[model samples]
Target chain A: MTNTILVLESVVLVLLTVLVAGLLRSHAEILRRLHALGAGLDPDAPTSELASMPVELRSRVSGSFATAADLDGAGLRDDALHVAVVGTRHRTLLAFLSSGCLTCQTFWTAFGEPARLDLPDDIRVVVVTKDASEESVSALRKLAPPNVSVVMSSTAWSDYSVPGSPYFALVDGGAGRVTGEGTGAHWDQVKNLLRQAADDASDDSREVRIDRELREHGIAPGDPSLYRTAEQIAQESRA
Target chain B: MTTTLAAHGLAIGLPTGWEGRIQRRAVSVAAEQTHAVVHLANFALPEERDDFGGGVTPLMRSADVFVVLFEYGPDAVGKPLFATQGIPRVTADMFGSKRLQRPLPGQLGCQRFFTAHGRPFCLYVVAGSRAYLPRILAEVNGVLTDLDVAP
Candidate 1:
């Protein structure tokens, strides 16, 4: 009977050892999973697993234009060339030109053909030229399109930060922000800038709409998990 | 969500459900000192209060993405685009020792350098998972494209 009892004790010890080993292995597996998940969230974690991934070059400036500063001055189109840029419903394009500058003549020549300007209806193009003699004004008047507004202001060059003649700036009058600004050396370049600004404005509104959707779902802007997906766990595991 | 780093003359569009903060640090290279602005965004995790004896260890301050803008002097003209030599292999040095190099495959997110109005700038983006990388990159590209650098 003692032998049988000893055998039974040995069997129990073997069984206990196996169970403990199994438990340890299971615990290790759990720890490994936790580690993987933690690493996924770590920005410093090495991404060697992704070394073979393809690199894509995407345009950063597509449909975007440089931000413009607020134009500081007063008054709308009257006898004076200065127009009140601060409060207006339509977007304003301040074309800074001078009657004396040769480059301004080229810009004015381009401006003569309104159809060629290809500006959207919403953009109210205003010619801001330096005060000139009657002769210069008459020359400029012949070049100015009938639909475009023409004004004369000596302060515009300094106020608009136009380093020289043949410069242009697009102002979103509602926001009082410069949407675009550059030298009007090429009419195509000016047109591209305007298109880019309009595209950027639309893109901004789209982003706002997306932000609203996230807010409705109780997610705020800057939430890192905003783009998290159910498949992310699988992707992390593969990595 | 979108916020502007007005001091750096930058505007960034943050992913929805994320939170962001800006920290500015002064850095110097070869006696030329400049400011580096870091826009850090992270997951909006709920606060976990420690109730037991285990000390309250702060959650790791790891972020999903970091947008770093190196501010140069107005007179600083960026090196030509063709001068791609010696682009720092490690990003830790750019932000100082505090940051880490969490590069994507081929260092895609951390590789490129940019210039605006003659000011040199670099961007680094990190994603929690490969699945989110493409979208994050696209968004980052948008921000960089529309970036307004003060001249």
Candidate 2:
């Protein structure tokens, strides 16, 4: 009888473990949904491990900015783009780059000719590099395009949690949040990523509008009208 | 929205549709002293420009405005023009054609000398048209309001 009881208790303990695992998964899903809805993210999340690698790109948070202050060896150039700026109304693409990285060469050239990259006319592109202490101002000035601004702020690298050299973050100015961020091997990949993120953001807004309209018409989510009945589906499929 | 750009012991917040740069020429000769030159403009700046803005000032449209903060040698620190002793606050009324270093038709310019952070500098402003002074100066003032100099 004692052995039987022990086996029963062991079975119950295994069941309990499975139950806890399920609950944990559900909680994770809930957190993921919350993040999708723009909730509970710390914009000031500390710099990540990726910035140290200087070869991959990852996403990060808010940062500081300073310009017109470090033109000592910059020659005739106006200012270096080693600034950390936040965009409010316009979509700003923060290219967290390093002066010493060879991977950044393509991006620098692409940004100099942003029009050829097929970016939207409204996007404001800026490059961010480490502060003067870690970079060569003259070299950066040489690589910097006459039209684009290269902000030099080490805090920007940390603010965005950039681990290494060439990473890109697309900050939605209207939403005031990073929509998508990752590293790309070249400008084409980076441009496509940005375009895709912009498209996704717009689609989300479209869905939200549709949802609002349905509610305004007294049709809540999961309403019968939102989904066709089996008979209607059959008829549509047949047609 | 404004972008605050701080470099070379100088800082300024550039307003929307405006850009600014601070540059210091290295002392190429022993007799020549180094000083910072800041250029702020509402329109697009060209690739080439002198310390006094000779190349770009001519491109200003009727509603455009150009500002230059040209730092002078330390010897001019105590001069009467530099006696104001701080970043000068610009008023629309302070600009006139007579103050232009090289005046051109339809453009009115003003110049102010001041010392900040023990450095003497000239604040020169040019408005494309006097009729647009109020609007032009308002934008210029908004940009300069964020001006700073660190020792």
Candidate 3:
């Protein structure tokens, strides 16, 4: 009886070990595939890192790249110019989306509706889709918002290094640089991101004004008076 | 900062606050290489615009700048109208409201026909405000410096 029990125990142990090994291999393979698809495991990583990321907002690497890719129309015969994202007088919002994504539907509907965006500011919005090869043109045509420009450019996807759908990039045409970019599942979440970008811009302008005033008062960088401790600042303020 | 937009061997550099695109229109699944159109502007461009800014120019605000680079058949190259060897350096005086495709108020338009890089092309520009013509033309010229011909 004892010998039989030992054999049975060994068999069970072996089976368990094999199962664990198989599971580990499967997990590793899944991660590898995700990585291959440009999906980043970390939220703090670059925009493309989290390709098709969850419906959450993440502040991206500010000024990650100096310029954005110019958008060329993919499968459309319309007279739309290959839209440029840089060097514009006003702001432009590039929405990277797909026709089939369930998460993207909310956005399409929101943008397609005749109602205003009620966005943080007045901005030109453009929808970009992968080449017709990867996306369904018929579905897109049905979903294409009358208010926004839809361009089917696979090159634009690779050029922008977009990892997944439902991504947003705000381009300051005057500066011709990406002021803000990230992924959002819905318009409400995306709207907050735009608001945050606007706040950051406002903050930057305020800082610039403060710095100019200080310089006008003859206080430059590394000035001793600027390095005063909190106590000194409090005392001066009190005075 | 400036970004370069190139396609079909034609390239142009866009300066800060200037956005534009290059395209060879596709009739079906296959893209057509003929009649490439390049549009550059210093204002927000609407998606519904025609090659000549049908939906966009009407929305231009004061001080906006729009440039259109319309490509023609290679046969159009070296014609008297396109006799210029390279993209002509646009001067301020070359612009006037009369040159506009439509007589829009407070706008000035300039058109130049030239050949560059073995291709025939027309360079069209519209100034949103006539008072800012010289300054806007200067900005347009700054960007045109990077214009490339075929290949």
Worst 10 residues of 2 chain B by lDDT: B40-49
lDDT score of residue A207 within candidate 1: 90
- Evaluated at residue B141, the lDDT of candidate 3 is 88
DockQ-derived CAPRI band for the predicted complex in model 1: incorrect
Provide the lowest-lDDT 10-residue window in model 3 chain A: A49-58
Kindly give the number of clashing pairs for every candidate. 11, 27, 8
Candidate 2 local lDDT, B1-151, one digit each (tens):
3467666788787765566667777667898868777877766555567777788878778888888888888789788878997777777678777878777888888888888889888998888998898888777777767787887
Candidate 3 Cα errors over 4 Å, as ranges? A1-55, A59-89, A129-142, A150-163, A169-185, A195-239, B26-34, B74-79
Better of 2 and 3 by DockQ: 3
Please provide, for model 1 over A121-186, each residue's C-alpha lDDT reduced to its tens digit, 9 standing for 90 to 100. 667677776666322766665767655556665656666666666777888766766777766345
**Candidate 2 clash total?**
27
Tens-digit lDDT track for model 3 on A1-239? 99999999999999999999999999988866655344437546544433444444444434464367667655344333357666555677889999887668778888976355786455878899998788888899899876687888888888777888878888787776677777775576677777877888888899999999999999998999988999999999999
lDDT against the true structure, per candidate, is 0.51, 0.69, 0.76
TM-score for model 2? Answer: 0.59
Individual DockQ of the candidates? 0.01, 0.12, 0.22
User: Candidate 1: global Cα-lDDT?
Assistant: 0.51
Name the regions of candidate 2 deviating beyond 4 angstroms. Answer: A1-84, A87-89, A112-115, A136-142, A230-239, B1-21, B27-30, B39-67, B74-86, B95-111, B115-118, B125-151
| Candidate 2 per-residue lDDT over residues A159-182, each given as its tens digit | 666767787777765455667677
